[model samples]
Target: MHRFKILFVCMGNICRSPLAEGIFKHMTDNAARAGEFEIDSAGTGGWHQGNPPDPRSVAVAAAHGVDISTQRARRIAVGDFDRFDLILALDRDILRNLRKIVPAGETDKLQLFSRYARGIDEDIPDPYYGGREDFDRVYTMLLTGCTSLLDTAGKLRTS
Candidate 1:
């Protein structure tokens, strides 16, 4: 069984990407597909490396029954381009940054995290500077996007 490797990206690993990683991991685990996927999160910048997800992000995920507090922040690395089958960026700017550093011939692996989301066609908003409401909103958006992303991954596997 070849597991599909996925890495979520945001400005800092302490927020959105970590949330997405946790949410997606929870979804897959609940579905009994956890062994079929490799999920992780990274930031475009190195500022947050070695730290945990922002307190708000941890609290938001916990409120929704997922625990992301154990996950540590890390910066995107050159090897990640070869390691992950898919690299999902939380926003356009992050996506652009990933594109810039992606090795040639690996562009196809990069995509916006919202690509499979039902009604959202843009980046997932950064909620770092906002309040609890912003974190809640981001959690909702990630739930929807992660669900659709799993569906997309399933389809790709079968194809």
Candidate 2:
């Protein structure tokens, strides 16, 4: 079977991107259990390169029954542009950043996560502010996006 590589991106790897990574992993793993593809994530900035995701983000992901504790934050490498089949950005700035570096020949791999999501017509709101509630809510928002993201990946894989 063919496995598709996916990379989720955000400004800082510590929160939203990792959360999207985890949620997407959970959704894809479940799909794999029933037959599906592969997934991963990264950040556009290297600031949090070796750091773990914010504890609050971890707690929220755990609440959803997904384990993201072991996933360390990493900046998107130049090579990742060639590696990932899909590159989903969390918001506009990162999307713009990705566009700048996505190589003139490889820009087709980039797409906003929300564009793949039917009802979510905007950016995946960053939840770096507020508290646990913010993280939890962002998790829910990303959950829908992840499911929608995977459903799209599934179709391309089978077709």
Candidate 3:
């Protein structure tokens, strides 16, 4: 009866990570699989702590039928390493940063989000400084990646 816990990470929680969390949550909920997983997101830094996902991110997700409006920004906490079965980083830089903070023996939990995405960009670039299209592009990528992420998680559940 253990839920598979996942924590998506990026430079700031207001952007990439929240979108990932939202997309995955929305997908699971729609598939009637929400109870099988526990999903959340955080940033490598705490700059946007307590703030909701960026307006652009919220809008983008909303456009795609997913509401990320209520997700608040937070930093990658120490206990998260132990709490989550997977800690997925949106980009290599964030993955590297996560490596530095992950506690010993828990390193196996860390992975690049794009690894689930085959034949696509290896990083989900930050769209914080760009215009609406940037957020849209990231959304497309997340949709693709999150789909694969859920597939992988399902396999892990069975094995």
Candidate 4:
């Protein structure tokens, strides 16, 4: 079976992207489709490299029964363009950064994570400086987006 690889990106891997990765992984695992996908995350910047997700992010995911505490922050690498079937950015700026670094011929793989979820036509807000409510909001956005993303990926896999 060919596994579809998905990579989520944010400015810092300690927040949004890690949440997306955890939510997507949890959803796929629950659907018994975990083996059919390769889900991971990275950041557009490298400041947090080797660091675990922010404590708030870990707490938010844990509240929803998904553990993202183990995921480490990593900067986006050139090889990721070829490694992932889908490269989803948390916001427009991240997408632009990714576009600037993506090798030619791989631009088609890049997209905004919000494209998957209806009504959420903007970037997932960064909650790094906000309170619990912000993290909760981000978690809700990620959940909706990841659910929609999995649905879309499943269709692509079948076709």
* Local distance difference test scores for all models: 0.91, 0.81, 0.91, 0.92
lDDT by residue (1-159, candidate 3, tens digit) is 789999999998999999999999999999999999999999989999999999999999999899999899999899999999999999989999999988999999998998854445499999999999999999999899889888889778632
> Candidate 3, overall lDDT?
0.91
TM-scores, all models, native as reference: 0.96, 0.91, 0.96, 0.96
Name the weakest run of 10 consecutive residues (lDDT summed) in model 1. Answer: 150-159
Please identify model 3 stretches exceeding 4 Å from their true place.
Answer: 117-121
lDDT of 4 by residue, 90-154 (tens): 99899999999999999999998896554466999999999999999999988988888888888
In Å, residue 157's CA in model 2 sits off its true spot by 1.8
Q: Which ranges of candidate 4 are over 4 A from the true structure?
A: 117-120
Model 3 poorest 10 in a row by lDDT: 112-121
Q: Per-residue CA lDDT of candidate 1, range 71-131, in tens?
A: 9999999999999889999998998898899999999999888864454668899999999
- Indicate the residue-level lDDT of 34 in model 3: 99
Alpha carbon lDDT at 104, candidate 2: 69
- Write down the RMSD of candidate 3 (Cα, Å): 1.4
True lDDT of residue 86, candidate 4: 88
Rank order by lDDT, top first? Answer: 4, 3, 1, 2
Listed per candidate, the RMSD to the true structure in angstroms reads: 1.4, 1.8, 1.4, 1.3
Query: In terms of TM-score, how similar is model 3 to the real structure?
Result: 0.96
TM-score of candidate 4 against the unseen true structure: 0.96
